[model samples]
Target chain A: MTQEVEMKEAQAPPSNSFSSASTPSTLQHLKEIASLIETGAYAKEVRRIVRAVRLTIMLRRKLKAATALAFINFALVQGSEAHAKLSAYLPKEDEHDMDVDTASSASQGFAKHALPEIEIYCYLLVLIFLIDQKRYDEAKACSSASIARLKNINRRTVDVLASRLYFYYSYSHELTNSLDEIRGNLLALHRMATLRRDELGQETLLNLLLRNYLHYNLYDQAEKLRSKAPRFEAHSNQQFCRYLFYLGKIRTIQLEYTDAKESLLQAARKAPVAARGFRIQCNKWAVIVRLLLGEIPERTVFMQKGMQKALTPYFELTNAVRIGDLELFKTVAEKFSSTFSSDRTNNLIVRLRHNVIRTGLRNISISYSRISLSDVAKKLRLDSSNPVADAESIVAKAIRDGAIDATIDHASRWMLSKETGDIYSTNEPQIAFHSRIAFCLNMHNEAVKALRFPPNSHKEKESAEKRRERQQQEQELAKHIAEDDDDDF
Target chain B: MDPRLVEVTQIFGRFKASLLRNDFVTSSNLLSQLKVLLTKFPSLPPSFQRTANAYEELQIAREIYEHAVLLSVKTEDQDAFERDFFQLKPFYADLKGLIPLSPQEYPILGLNLLRLLVQNRIAEFHTELELLSSDALENPCIKHAVELEQSFMEGAYNRVLSARQTVPHETYVYFMDLLAKTVRDEIAGCSEKAYDYLSIADAKTVLMFSSDQDLSNYVTEEHPEWEIKNGCVFFQKAKDSQPCKEIPSLHLINQTLSYARELERIV
Candidate 1:
């Protein structure tokens, strides 16, 4: 049984929370049970071990609970093959009632009547097990049962457990694309977390809400929530990484490339090595943001360990942008069209076409002092013939964007590169710098405004009341001091 | 008949009448009502005894959304246009077999293609294109966008600019004008580089402005660096104000002497 648990742990995703250490006694009992089953021990002995495992869980040995639940499931499978047939023969409603009846009867044998806490615990354990098994429908049903039972319980000790169940419930809705259901449940969970001052719960629920908003392309609502969400440092590295990544994505859409780049870089650097998929996604957006800011991404960005295969398309895209090859860019875009669409980076990539043209025109200007518009067209591979007008427009755009220093003569259809002295002395660079600083300052002010305080809590209210009393006492003391001074006069 | 279907039909009729009269305010209100009504009706209306009724319902919904998109365009409400277009998109995407689209579908789809191009959403442009039947590509409306995109991608700005004249639909004229403005701006930038000044007439012709006043207004608004004086548009400031760079005549003479010595040695 220990070996089986270890194998399962190894096979599970790195994000799974089951890697924490379990107690030695639990492992020993599990090992003994596995050996007993392997040696064809009697059903009574197996049932005794299962009861022992359940006792350990009831004793609050939380670490080994998953193993205990798995052992129980295994015992049921081995001791009563008829149980599966019974469940299969019954309707779903009847099956659920029968399971509950058996559980109640089993509990009566252990304790006079089943405790609601124990029932809730049993349901929660089953829900987690089903979720781990990728049985979403069964997990959904199990979570609903656990949540319903949780309402009758005192819930003070079980708030975290209830939050977990709600998370799984909403996750099931997400998997099914029941957007409205997910939103409603998440909102309820958010309200509960806010009222309880559960910082971690709030962060988790807010992240889920952000994911929903982004999935629906509702950035405005996501921004509103970001501003209103309480400011607490995320307790988990994974959650922090996700928070920064979403912030970066929102900033990118708003055209705040500098801040977006900073956030994306931080997210990429802080992402766990095991979370290769998340890191790759961060790097993809980072690459695009960098390109948008007219900076070519370093080649090493694409060569990051474990991300090489995933970053290949973006690398080709960066290469096309760097070389300013319109034809190559088009080919790359068409080749990886599906990948871009799936990643939802297609819009950003499309914007890169203008960048490519700018770079191409800039290079052309540097190489030639004066060239006919027709020749320019040929060099840019714009058209086969009579491309003078097209070439003029492209050159015009290049000049306007400050990508090139050149002028067009209409009658002669010639483009002349500006003298080096004329290009550098313009006030454009200063204006550009000022605008960038203004943008940074604006973002800083926005961030300051967005910072949220914790919702009013009993402790905060008590502190406030104490402060008010202290202020009043100080005023009274000052009044007495003034009276004494008057007497002295 | 389903009461919801009857209401939808009634609202759609009002929407059509408002659109025909160019009453955007009334039309927009009716469209919102129709949207709400349609949502209450099942995607596959259950009251319909035949599958054909469901298909017809889908067709009516599609037409309503398409009209909403057109109304949004006519009013120049881009946000509404985008929302309406997305609502109409599923009908085009999913009901291909159940109900064939009307002939107007291609023109509107093509107009959307142009809109995407103008907005620089090339990836979505391709995605939408991929959803169409191969024969749809041959439609004049779709072909116009495909050719324009090809030209734009190939650096054939002239072709893209000229494409404005041959746009397949009236709705397309808006995006075409936007593209023309983009092209004209590009040309204006190049003109600043190649000449110190151009005659006002020549500037007007190169920038594709129809009249002198338009050219003058464009220069005043967009190109503050440009100076119009004495029938010429000067790209740079007046000659006296221009910064002069000192020529290195001694360096040039020395280089020429060195080259002359090398030639004498070779002879």
Candidate 2:
């Protein structure tokens, strides 16, 4: 209960009051966090430590060079190696305005050996500072040193801060374009985190490794590792969202468009609303995968708030696909070729060419019950020397893939589309209804499984004899009070 | 200093010398012997045991397997290429810092890629391509195979057929020839459906066949249904194909109605 009180002290009003105050009060809050960590470590309650780390996130944006210098001077012993290194990382002139309290705190709490949690926290602070400062090379060096220090410390209290450190470690290496340099190191760290049963560390490192692999278009390796990694309930929403995004990308590249669409849509839905950029990426991919699967996504997807401008090219691309215009698709692809390549989705767009042909063939077969091969080729706008032949094969493949119901007449060079039947007369609706029911049942089962009961509530029940005894005691007290009143009279 | 390394090193040297002399039989024997000796090296993959000279052992073993892959190419033995390429993959994937980059890496990797394309194993081709670094994807050898794959998927047979003339390395010729056959077959499958008949000379040009004999031989072996009459290829039309079965609408409607009733009752 005391630790819970400490947790509230760090969590409840800091972020809300953060905007209600100025820089001095923010620095004051930063100083209070040091004491919180000290008490947390002394009491061996990790939740307090976790709360201290959470508070740093709220203060992260308001941090300046002088605040970092003063915080470092107060957190570590004055003139220690870490203090000197951290102070040197800040600008030299920012220390001119340190308040009296920070200076007194620096003099007061200069312990010879800071706790491991505090050490990792300082590393997190400096790393976030350097990365925000755009000093990636320095950030890389700092993160490497942090990771080395992290490996020697095995305290469970340090796990939360260590996970944050691992995140910045991979982020800095990625910024330096030297992720290849630390692939083996990251793997070793992941193994260590697994052995320690640090679920958050495992989740963060697994996502980082996937991002690393997918950075170089290594879908095969990413899939192999993802399948073999230990599965557990997610400990962090943000990391799980990232994991889903990478999985969607791998599935997209591997031609599993249905599964890819599900993952990408889930990722977009589960992402925090503030993460507009990530949501836009997920939506863009979901649209393309749906297009490839022969399903045009809803219009509101492209018109999503804050996503309209970035998704305009995809909207135009989707329009071209919807109409089954090969020429328009070609132009749209050419116009946004740079954007697609930058997104590393040009390979997926290249695959979309077949989908374009299939869409064109489906439209043509629907409108024309009987058409010559050359006419079909002309309608599709196939640009090859043998357009008729290419059109024939495109139609053949589409037919074989169930894109259309058409038969080719080789002797007369005509495609004879079969008469369209009413879809409602088929078992399609039955199957669709059955699937919906199954989906509802599955969701109910999942919700039931997710329902959590309060711990030991069943033990709160009272025995009948205890209730009767309590009632008798109440009557006796009432009678004694009445007898005392009569005696006073 | 390890005797197993010394023995593997000597056999690898002999393999290279025999390969250069074009004595394939002797080089083949040397390659097999070198592979067996490499298994004894503690530093190789699936073991990765560190020795005093682990780097040297790994480098030599990699070279021997690289040569063996190219040898399979030279010998036009597809099975051996697959086996040797798999054995050599760990060296490229595992030993990045141990040894300097091999000059033969891109060409051989590209060759394996082209082989996959020829076999129409597109998924594996992509998987292999993914393992390469971004810089490697820019190599002309890899770029050539990638463009060929793109063209193949786009059904641009003319470009695919023309790509054979611009082979980046000599070893690519064999796979390019096989890929050309695949492209021609793809085109053949399409043309027979599109045209009622084409002149013999037109079919020759369309299939990229050099002579009437090759055209007739292909038609006879691959599509016996296609008849050559009046100096033109007359493809078999839809006469022999099975008619489409009609959907039983009444039965389907009954099933759907029953399902709706059951759903209504449950609700």
Candidate 3:
């Protein structure tokens, strides 16, 4: 599915590319260099590689036009080393002559004329590098300056680039908790995308807007936007993964766990191999949703490659639930309490406490035919002393939930399990089964409703108009052809 | 003086007065306005040669938000408290060495942590814990919450209940009351299974209800099946109202007799 999306994206109008002057050989060398770095082979000859790339850029002055492309590749491979080199070449923001011509002259590039487009590319690369280094403050400044430059130029071609830059700028604000600034930027971007009828841009902006809303715990706003946001066909794996992940999160927050689980599972499956972080996050939410729906996640979920360490806390949590040990569940919850809270699954985990107790009661009922309520309380660790009242309530709740098969004998102060034959004939099991089926059916209906596509009224109107115009044009062509035929005759 | 500084001061003054008077509505409105003003201020504040002035302004803003959080708690508006707490969180987490935090910061931070615990947001509880300095962690207000959480998780209900008395701050009482209720409810559940009947006095003592009316109301609301008559709370209603399944003793005897006959025939 992801491959299909990628194919469609490749066929669509490209949003951003390296450069018009990019050569296949340069890209190949870049890839080779990246591989060398990945394999640690470039460590010993790092300086030599840097010098060689610099020399090549200098010899082929035309290559200087795509300097941002090379620098971006270099940053990916060289890490901090590229940051230092790029910083040395980057023009200071406050400098009056901080333009492409001045930067080209200062860097000793043989190209007499400097392309403003290349300057924008360089600014974007630098912005990316700064953000990658966790210098969000500097990245914000760089993005703002780049955006200001873009606005000064007012070039129609750079609108896409400006939108991308604005996303980073707003992202920095989000990280800093400048809520109003982030909201303002997103609203402005939303308006721009609407004006241009840029479906892909609207989709991207909507995802960011939804994220902002969720970040601030603005569920009402998020719900309002989800119902109204422009729906666009997701043509990239990253976009599709994001779209599904956001949908799943919103559904989870609304307690629509079944639909959440499906969307989250699809997101995890469609996520790129390189985006393992995103995939892991999706799985974490999926695991929580499944747990909420009274389904035990398989042990294999915790053991997936690259996910073991990140999932260890959840694995222990699942184990505690599986063993029906309330104390162990509590211990595990406390031990990894930070992990659950940070993942925003703490509320769901709290709900699991009742499940743990129910499971414990079930195990207890199976083991003993008749036990005093106080003894059951002691075994279940309900209270330290005089737990008779607490134990009775726990047992009563357990029996009500159908977690245990037993009867409370008030006079004898004992819980008695039904004889084997009597247990089978009771209507309780049937009721439980019916409720489970009902819940499943309800979830299925909700998912189907959620997955239903919105009516594409605008698209339909556009197509209908286009068809009429084409019919008129065809009739005119037919008349012209008949006139020409008469002349030939 | 910068005109913005005067505006910030006037706003802060009004916020402080509103908070003192317990006017949460006005205080929250002031906070929103302050937040907008702060958002518009350049983060790095280019005019300031050093970051000291900017950091001081940020600290003041943080304190105001902290007051807003307290006000939310006082008003029993949990959602507002959560929003205010998060709004203050970034300032605490990001401005590590720029300025010294007020003495009230740790207590407020601890109160926030306890709120998360009561809400069962353990993950976020730990996330907040991870952000505190070692010294802050050792502070009594913070340690109080950490200990309560430990006891609760360990099934030491007694300790959890006892910790309520030692709650470090006035605001801590709200969350403490919530935690106390949760603990009592868990005990109530266990008690219902453990006993057939308890005298009204014993029920009150066991459930930690201070008044007879409170215990009676609790029983009436939570356990309608429990009959409260003759000064005792009966966990189960009269036998006739209870569902009973008859034991098939005759079937068991017949099976035994058939087995013996089969043995005799084989011999």
Candidate 4:
């Protein structure tokens, strides 16, 4: 241990101790390096003892000591030659750790002890960790560096790192909302998946890729990928179920309604019954399509069955109102709207309920005098200048006129995302309009901000900005119609 | 015993006497009773073994009806004879010493039932069409039906086209006579036989003649004042009346489906 400490101390000040390394012959020094690693491994055993201290002792303190020992072992074994090469390129170990930790994560204390492979591993790990943490820029740099190093190796280490690259790339692109880049990386991963022929890897990569594709209305390519999707074994039921669920979406986009119904049903069946979340989503969509097909009796049966299951809180609320169960709809909607202050789902339910109220008011022969539409509107915060109001007016007019043949021209402004096109494209003036309605409901500010893009620009960039501006204006006007101006519709 | 029965006996006896000597008066009452018996037991004896060997042949008819169900016996059954067999089974069977006669049966009931079966087959076809509509066309069952229907329609069209070159001379003559009889019976069902003659006179002229002619010649011969033009026959009427003409045989045959639809409404 003393010799190992002496070696570290001597190595710490490289410029000052330039001639210190000529103290011993090559064979003897190699032996000394080997002994130092042996002592370092021994030090790990010593730190293991300190880990048993009471709760007041932070695990980080002991973990740092243990990592120090492991680093010494790594330096003695693999890092000697690697360190010599790295020394010319990198700063001293302590300073490098401080820089990486401060830049990436303050919590990654004592990262210096990590070996070259471990260091590469740590970068890959941090890339994934930062992505999960939503630190995309940090994750991107680490991921890029890991990818560079990964190209140099031919071992399973490279495979693991490459896998990490897929996840990091996927997460970072998703965070930055760069769906096109996300799509490219996902396609690259899919190619990797084909090369490896790893079922799990292919499924994971395809699921992410398909999600981006579906978001962007690139359904044809999504369908081609779907045809090549591997069947899920029983062990991978969740992944398989998710794959089928998205496949159903792709089928729907293709206008293959019956096939879509069958695929969605299959996904629901494969998904655990107790996983009410997925089941609810699947059932809600299935019912919506069935309803639009004029299969009212079927819609009723499905909605009734869905209500008993574990649907998302927002889905439950909208569906309850959809079925004309005003009491249940009000209860669920009020609770959901209050609980989620600025959530997308809560906003959607509020919008739907506001529409219901407006519809009731329009058809006043049925007598909605018992309920206070204004109070309900206030509770839903329909007064906010956002999409809910704009959408409500459009929907009410459509219902009054008996059909919606009009296109949502305002969508161009709102949908101009740098990453994903409007996720709400289908939702406006169409069957699943709730999603757009919900989006407008939850973050009207962001929705309004998105719509600030100019409407009349020939250039993609300028047009995108105009489109964003138009979207914000539309959202604001929609909010006004739904809330303060009951007479508007 | 009743005036209506006595009158019916007198009429039936006159009809029966035409088949043999005119000795029907003595047994007219018994024969009328036998006619009633024939109507009562229109089918064969329930059990063949219970009767003598002679009675075994009497049950040949029961076997025919069962065979009719399976579509095995095609030639023996005649519509008129079948009506008479059911109408006068006991009266005809009373002369046990004579050779046992084949029962004539209304083959239409059987054909109608078979048509019903065909309709069921069509229903199954419709189910496949529904499957196609539902995007389940790739189902093996649907694929098989589609292939089968496509083959059938193609084959049927080819056979119809090929058969148009060769006239079915014998069957054509037979069908002409059958059609005349069918028209007579159908017209009689609508009104008295006297009322049917005017409408059936042109049809009867074609049935009575053994001469062969193409549709144009047949139409010209049947209606001497008619002209054939564009595959149609038009006739000039007397100066004071509107023109009326018999349709050409070929045109009638071509429009047979329209005629059938017309006949269905009339019936």
lDDT of 1 by residue, B91-139 (tens): 7654666778677789888988888888887656765654555578789
B67-123 per-residue lDDT for model 4 (tens digits): 332221123224533443333333232334444433322222223222222233433
lDDT of 3 at A484: 29
* Residue pairs with backbone overlap in model 1: A390-B158, A396-B186, A396-B190, A397-B186, A406-B193, A407-B193, A407-B194, A408-B190, A408-B194
lDDT of 2 by residue, B48-90 (tens): 9888888898888888888999899999999999999999988
| Model 4 ranges off by over 4 Å | A1-123, A148-165, A228-235, A265-287, A290-489, B1-267
Error of 2 at B195 (Å): 12
Query: How much is the lDDT of residue A308 in candidate 1?
Result: 95
How large an RMSD does model 4 have? 35.2
**lDDT, model 1:** 0.67
Which of candidates 1 and 2 is the stronger one according to lDDT?
A: 2
Question: What TM-score does the predicted chain A of each candidate obtain versus native chain A?
Answer: 0.63, 0.86, 0.61, 0.40
Model 4, span A1-489: residue lDDT tens: 012123223333432333323322222232232333333334543221111111101111112211332333333233454333322222235523533333234223323443333444434333533443345676665555555565454433234334535555655665566667556556765776666655555666777777677555456567777787665553245556667778776655444557767778787777664455566566655543343332332334444453544335535554564454445667776676543333212322332443343333333313332223233234333333443332323222332333322211121211111122344442233324435544544574465556756465555655777779657756754554322211100
**In model 2, which regions exceed 4 Å deviation?**
A1-21, A42-44, A79-81, A91-102, A105-113, A456-489, B1-17, B20-22, B32-66, B86-106, B118-120, B130-144, B147-267
Ranking by DockQ: 2, 1, 3, 4
B-chain TM-score of model 3:
0.77
What's the CA RMSD of model 2 in angstroms? 11.1
lDDT of 1 by residue, A389-448 (tens): 667767765665567767777778898897666533544554466467557656766777
Q: What are the models' TM-scores?
A: 0.62, 0.77, 0.55, 0.30
